[model samples]
Target chain A: MTSTNHTLFEDYLRGYISDEEKKRLELVLDSSETEREEFDLYKTMRRTLSPNIGNPYKERELKEHLEELGKKYTHEFSNEVMEMPVVRKAGYVRRILSVAASFTLVGLIGIAAMIPKNTSKALAQAYVYSSDSTAPSRSVNGDNLITSSEEYYLSGMQAFKEHKYETAIISTRKAKVGASPELIQEIEWLMALSELGLGNDAKAKELLTEISTDTKSDFSGEAKELLEDLNGIMHRISSFF
Target chain B: MPTAKTYLNGIKQTSHKVQHPDQKYIEALRTNDMILVEDIYKNYGQMITDLVKKNNGNAQDAMDLFQEVLIILHRYSQEGFTLTCSLKSFLYTLCKRRWINELKKKGRAETLKVADISDLNFAEESKESVEGTEMYDQRFRFCKEKFNLLSPGCKEIIQLSWRKQEDGKYCSWKEIAEELDMSYAYIRKKASQCKARLIELARKDPGFKNL
Candidate 1:
């Protein structure tokens, strides 16, 4: 270990060394063991003293940056956001879905706040999407999958929840277009289940078979199980016939 | 101009690499040489985001990875290191290192056998950045905390001067003077003074010193 080096020495080591001084320091480093050790200690101390400055854009900075970037992409953003299947945008889905999904999550602080929370209808609508009957209009000419059609799917989800088996079929079928292949299978499963619930085993079997083939994971596995139940229902129906 | 041309050439030559660097829109990133590193965030950003997301991380992980790899590349440059592999590969290796260290720190270290080697190999001629990226990352965080404590004016002047390099030679004293609208000597002197104050601040903070 060497004796203390001053702040000037620290600065020089902190990339503040001049060309002449750099040469001189190099000579000094070569000249003696004590000088080398001193320089080494100084280097270590400067590095130890040097605070690692992070990159300029921190998380909040990036968030602001993203907002700025988002503005530039506004046309792209609005077009995509409007096309989002979830209906709600990134920052505000919860409030809209709260009243929309059902009145179940709506606490006792209810219709006194506004329209009364319809508990029975909301509960019955729990398993299914309620039907709005409006199919999102698709414009294939412009590569637009009719956006107007989602109303049916949303309604079907609500209708299934309310145990409206017949209405659930109509709403879900109407909402079925423009969804990805996976959701198509899911909608098929829902439709089949509702039909079986309404005692239409033959129609249920055909729809359930369609869902079983979409096989891509847990959801498909459940569809397969339901299909087996539908087959069992078919055997009983045939026996009665 | 020669150095800029050389870097541009370096970018062009890297096209055939195992990992292609993305550089179609370089001007978006505020960089002295966006030409060299443009492909970096574009090619590897999502892969990192996906990796982190898979491991219970989030967009914050992507930010950390992006910044740390940059600091690592900058430090290597300050040490006169050369690039061997395409920038894409080097960035991939550096980001993976940062992510691995972060996971270990989180106390749920699951070192998956991620199959990615194209980015880890550097040209044999370029100096190894085999060390101190982790250290610099910590140091940078410390410096940033201290930076928050500095006078706004000091922070501004320091950042402006720090970004003055164009072809990696401080652009020009005259240009900087014009930009700052001050005499050349004044710009140089004020920059030094601001840097000195930054050092003093760093020196005093125990956390900064640890980094």
Candidate 2:
């Protein structure tokens, strides 16, 4: 190709050329196999240089996420298997009833029996926790009411596990209202996930930003992971569409 | 006798029905569905581990290979890739092939025992898909490295030109030039020159020829 043709090719690839110039360049490429080959290479290089394709930083983050998930599952799978039979048997009754009349009684029983003794342990096994410290367990009210902040937190976790995220958000927000400062961070982290589950990405992101900015927050590691995960998911969803 | 038009239409129809069962897995990977990913590990992790171990590899190698395959699938899914067979079979084929390639690279190909993989038919399209992903990844790394090597001014100009807003429109060169306090023609020429330099640097690598 001539020097002029090469410059035109570069200009065309950079999208700086006029329509007429593009047409002229295409005509030249269409007439010569060698020119066409060079044009193809230029086109491929342009695409490869684009920030959207095969981003190494995003790829690294995803790899780390997958590795963490693998490790967590490997450690938890055995325990989950042992617990599965018991959960299945007890969970059957909860699945069968849908009536409002017995709802409160069932919820109490579910919280009593369904909420495992080490509920936090189960949550830790199943999900990445932002904080290393566990929330102190408060006694459940026998009157089937959420009285203590701890009960409210547990209720939110239970609803979250059941994928009832909106309810989880409400209960978890209530837990945050009068909780000790230590527990407030944990509540905010769970509330972020609840917001994510409800497809309230902006709200979830806001919560994550708050958690991540608090240097002393025990949930910083988890908050960072969720924040990156949220960004990755949003980017992928946008790209897919 | 069928006409040429009918024959071409038949080919198109056959291509349309080549949907594979692993599409859901691909979608799950793209969406970063942890539950499905964990399930995949549960279902196929042992098989991959055994396959790697039986072929002079270890559990760690198996894990690495599995993650690499998933990463490749994730990358390809972004480019509108489709599966043409069961995910299990496709994954097994990819993992096995990659393991063999690794062995070859390490000069252990002579000692490699060919496992019986008659049941796993690696389709032509699947092979192309794997190769294409590898090529794209190779080129992407090369371009990224070269772009990073450019002067700071060049890098800044090139990046600004590629920056797209949330509305999917690129930031105009006029705006970029104004922000940078440079002439519009200079910015455009500089971006093109930086890109050309990147392409030139990438081409200097022998691996680029193969890609």
Candidate 3:
């Protein structure tokens, strides 16, 4: 009911309380249902939010790794679907649908061209890539021999700045191997930006989705903003059809 | 009735010990073993994609669902959870249940086309595991959401209070006090007050009962 009681509860939970204080606190908790319930909730919160010391970055690392796996497997699945057999009798029907689809695709493209170009692309272009706060800084002209990770990361950022998105993507992907958690987060952000600059919306969206979902990532806010823009464009396009 | 301490301790116990053959997958998730995790995706990824797509979802939705389910798996594995069924069955069951829940939330439940889960041999165990994990995940998420609603000062002190140092030991109040430029007594009291506020917020939520 009071801050003092909560402090006592905390002391007791952390085993910092003396025997007398612990007994008093237990008595108070036992006598009052409201206090007991509060203790339960507080205890649960402490347990739930306790940091994973063994691998503090497990979720972030796993998410990034799984994003790559998802991309690969999804691509394979799509190819498998394409290679699947179709009935010979439906060839004419398929041809007719193909013709209609072609016209629809052209019509959609024309409409897309007439509208203001996708705002997502504009937003992605305008997104300023900030360096990760946790990542260690290295001078480009440092006398020390650069490690592979550093080399790739530096080149990736260089390519990104030069507007060579394909090169940026390639360099960052190489940089991701054996990188620190901070560097991995930065590399993924860079890769997402490269994908966006190259107008590869699906890959950009996939990369952004992974980054945005991580609340602790440095680029999460920017990723979320870009994702919202991308989703808005997608919704508008889908609704038009 | 058991006291809160006993109840909390019970949850912390290694409740299940009969490890299934699929326990390796849980370990892979917990340890962030990228190669094993990729193997998990290679083996079960298509199955999940098919499950989601069959239920009116797209590739992106399927990907999102897969990542989410993996997160749940990771959490349970961290808590010393033992697999009583095959990982595939457990994952498939969780995904299937979660997809349905998503559809229900979106008011598109009627459009859900159920996948054939008849071949999943450990149906009851899988269902029970899914339910338990869902409840645990929901409760944690609810409390975390409430924790985020506290004042900035409250959140910071509470976070820094139990934060681990390089040696993997929790920071003492004195250390936290120095870090925050406050007295030890003040830091401890602030963290306690903040924690109390967080718990109170959770208790006051309309969905507290559900959690």
Candidate 4:
């Protein structure tokens, strides 16, 4: 190729070529197989050199997110399996069942009560507050004993309040093995709520299923109600198709 | 087979079909839907863990491989890749293949068993998709390595000219030249020369020829 053609190719690769120049270059490339091959090679080189060129910020964000996920999975899998006791508080049972019944009614009525006019705007409203129910405090014994799992659980709760749902779930999962049976319910519930906030219906459903099946837990009724609501939503979404 | 006219008319008449199931999973990754991510782990975690353990690897190794596979999928989707199979199958195959490679790298190839993969039917399209991603990753590494070897000035010029702005525009040669306090014409020539040097270096690599 001529020096002029080579310059045009470089200019084209760098996106500096004007429409007219591009047309001329296209003609040159069409006229010779060698020029076309050269064009292809330069195109490949440009693509290879800049894989994340368009969204470096997004790429960096994704890398950070991946690192966080790695830490979460490592912590979750590395913990020793502990035999959990099925401890239930009689005082909380009635309140929990009442809350569950209310939620079940909401689910049966198309979730209109729980869901606001704007679904995205309703995420913050869905935060599961400890004060929402008169249920006995599992984490608030007189001694106020704290374990590493409880610390992680509290941190996870803080993260949830900050709308960092992924961090909340990770931290809560890290608390799983160390938490007492009573605290386990709260941790699982919060983790499920975080999942719901993040649009992970399937995951949220799975957690809720586990919670509902553990009838001994204070959150069992509430979990069953939430699972029904999730099912309702899924059914509605699928039917929209 | 339908005739060309029939196909064209049908295309005009019909609305788009339901999205593939895997598309939802892809969207979950893109949007950072942690719930979906957790569900993915719940569904496939044990299978992958077992595979890794049985193949002379551990849970940590499995997690790493799983995360890497997800990253690859995310990257591929960002580059306009579409999945043709169920997410479960695709993920399983990708993780299994990666774990096998990892084992082989650790000189445990003799212990690698094919029984796990025997029942997993990987579609031709999926195989091509994974291979294409692998090739792109290789080329990207090779190019990055060669580009880093260039002079500082060359690197700056090339990066400035090629780097995309937040608004999706490339910085013009004039802008780059002004930023660097160099003449536009001189900067243009320098960029071309730098590019030529990079191409020469890349060409010298044996893998580049194969690519």
Candidate 5:
């Protein structure tokens, strides 16, 4: 039950009172049904509400009357929708369409047409987009890159997860198409897997050694194990031959 | 013994621990990162605007909250309080608290809990404080309207002279003449006239005493 000093409820953790104090206080207020009711109200109010407090802010922006909050905040946003596998395809489709349209516009503008001329490349680009292409690709760059597709690479990922290593590698290789050298790490892993499945032990060892040297993670652990297996096989083959 | 290089290394370690946040390329009114200030605006701006309307506030009231909310954040971070919750939830609560405090300060007596604020979290952190803030903002808007109804020359004089201090939370009057492009003697007389007019408006308002 609440005392007349119900204002404590305004503070964080309801002032963190002891259970004995709480019970004694409740008993005191319980003397009157009205007091008990007030106590209950405070208790209920506390439960229903969250206790975190204080304002969050930056001095510079507040002065300008909400000038660029939207632009600034979007950068901090986690890109949750893009992260979900279900929505990722949608993100890809949106990116590709946007990119295609951008390209077509760019191409036509090069010819000095202001009406946003249409182009076959744009149409082709849109056709192979994730939504219509059924090739299951994603972008190598951030979701904004549309002209070059990551559809085949994404398909490789799906294939590998399905334990179809050869197909996955093939798909991964296609994914690397037109990609910057800064990229290709993810696709290269898949490509190495393709070689391993095709019994190309030497190539697999080379790829595994390179990846493991650059970084170490759960994936690196797997590559190391595979390297050991292939090295053992090569030793046995040499001895027998 | 850690000498000049050692002390420098210690400072470097502490700096790394602190992540030396970036403050480059500030655009006007952007507040997302250093204090998690930008996200606060995005998540709460609409809610505050809506709350104002629901409780007899106008778009202008909504705009004021945006400025005030950002100001409060600046104050809190400058004081070095850790933010343990999402920006959305934190901002909602602060605005609500400001509204309630403002109303209470005005002496409006319907003893209402934060419950009346639908936007605020009833359990305190479950949701943002839109409800509570809206309630208070509604009253502040009422106050703003009353302030606006005063003589325009008076209003213009007051606003032109109004300056947000370093912290941006407290408003005070100083050098009104410089701000208004007038002389000290002229400002003194104009301020007196403005004060009386303001008093009369407050007297006539039903919510003024409560406010």
Candidate 6:
């Protein structure tokens, strides 16, 4: 079908066309089975893609709800699988491996304690978003609408607020790619906060440095203050060593 | 013979059987009923996790596939699709097919260790439902893929144009044009051209013929 007819058919399907236009479109569609088929496809697409009718936001919520349920079930499933006799029976080699694993875990805990921790996390607890934080507003301006990046960024922020720091970091990193400069700043700020939430103080400090040094960044002022606080926390922690 | 309307509506029906008892699952999905949804996981979730785990996948993969399948089912349910077969058979078949396709996409098709499902012997009605849902899922994915490829401006315009206002009316092109700081004619033409491009892309796809 011609592009004109395609648009007309869409308009008719969307109820954007007048009765005359609808009649004209129907006459054109009546000319061939192919036309009708193409029109039907458009109709299907409309039915499927129409935001109000399809209620994509609700679909997303449902998907998230399902993901949570899936996670819970799979966690239980994994536990059940682990409890099976075949998996549970330990041989001599397995017993030895377990002993070594215990020693390794103890050594790792000692090393982790020696490393400065919790200070950054404490600092981040203040900087990171809470349930009281306002939700990200929808981008109304067409020029600013990078839908995927916006979606990822929003999800990242949501994860951050929920204390899913690892998920927040992953999502924010994805949002960083191909994002606008302004969005990149927001993403970087969130990433730094997520790193701090994860207790990766060095990574958080590095991200904060980048944002603070960028004069044009919206988060520069806050990042700079957080960097100073982070430094003081590190300084106090290092004094113990 | 099923015409375009039948295809547009849903899968062709061979029988007017009573709706399966498990139709509640579909309804639960549509309404986002948490109790029934959890029951879905309680009853059949293990089967999917086991299926994925045995086929070089982890619990996470199973979880992702499970969510995708639920979303697809929910979309079809919204389209008034009826459940003639048991939801278990339908979900199992759909997950198996989707996992295989996912494996292919990941270049692990050769490593797909899923046992031959033919022996399970899905009835004709279940097979039909699974196929129809898969087709609908594919078409939805295709449309989204094309929609994402549109210019950022076009995407925003199309999104805003189709989105309903608080009062339950689609935002007029003129309102969208003003919001986007563009002339009405330019906005209208852009929206039309954007939709045409999407349709044209779908039409040009060789796979669309079978769909």
lDDT of 2 at A52: 44
* Alpha carbon lDDT at A3, candidate 6: 61
Q: Write the per-residue lDDT of candidate 1 for residues A124-162, one digit (tens) a residue.
A: 233233322222232312343534345565566556655
Measure candidate 2: CA RMSD. 18.1
Error of 1 at A147 (Å): 17
Native A-B contacts reproduced, model 2:
0.14
* lDDT over C-alpha atoms for residue B170 of model 4: 76
**Quality of candidate 6 docking, DockQ:** 0.19
RMSD (Å) of each candidate, 1 decimal: 19.7, 18.1, 13.4, 18.6, 26.8, 14.3
Residue pairs with colliding backbones in model 3 are none
TM-score of chain A of 6: 0.46
lDDT of candidate 2 over A1-241, digit per residue (tens)? 4434544654565567898976776666667766665555565565555444323454566688779765554323312212101112346556566355478776767656643232222322234333334333444333455457877888887777666665666688679777877668768877777766654455567778999989988887777776675566443343223
Candidate 4's residue-wise lDDT over B25-135, tens digit each?
A: 777666567678667776666666556655655456667788887766665555455555667566766777777777677556576644522323542325655565676
Per-residue lDDT for B10 in model 2?
34
Interface RMSD computed for candidate 1 is what? 13.7
Model 3 alpha-carbon drift over 4 Å, by segment: A52-56, A81-241, B13-17, B115-122, B165-168
lDDT by residue (A1-241, candidate 3, tens digit) is 8876776766676677798987777777777888887777666677666653223476778778888877777645422322111224458888999899999999988887777655534545567443443233454335587768778988877766767655666688789898777668877887787777655566578789999999888889888987887778564573354
| lDDT (CA) per prediction | 0.47, 0.62, 0.71, 0.64, 0.45, 0.71
Q: How many backbone clashes does candidate 5 have?
A: 34
Q: Residues B1-211, candidate 6: write the lDDT tens digits.
A: 4443344345234336478888898899877788998888887777777667656555567778988888888877765667878887787778888898887876666755555434155434488788878777787777777777888887787788767776867777678889999998887778778777777777888866765
Off by over 4 Å in 2: A1-18, A31-35, A49-57, A73-241, B1-17, B31-36, B110-114, B117-128, B135-156, B175-183, B205-209
Which scores greater on TM-score, model 2 or model 4? 4
Interface RMSD of 6: 7.2
Error of 6 at A233 (Å): 59
Q: Candidate 5 on B1-211: residue-level lDDT in tens?
A: 2222232133124222221122111111233343444444555566654444333232344556656766544433332323434444555566555565655664532333334433344226523233433433454455456556878787765444333345743232344566667776676567556544544565476665443
- The candidate that wins on DockQ is 3
Clashes per model (N, Cα, C within 3 A)? 37, 1, 0, 0, 34, 0
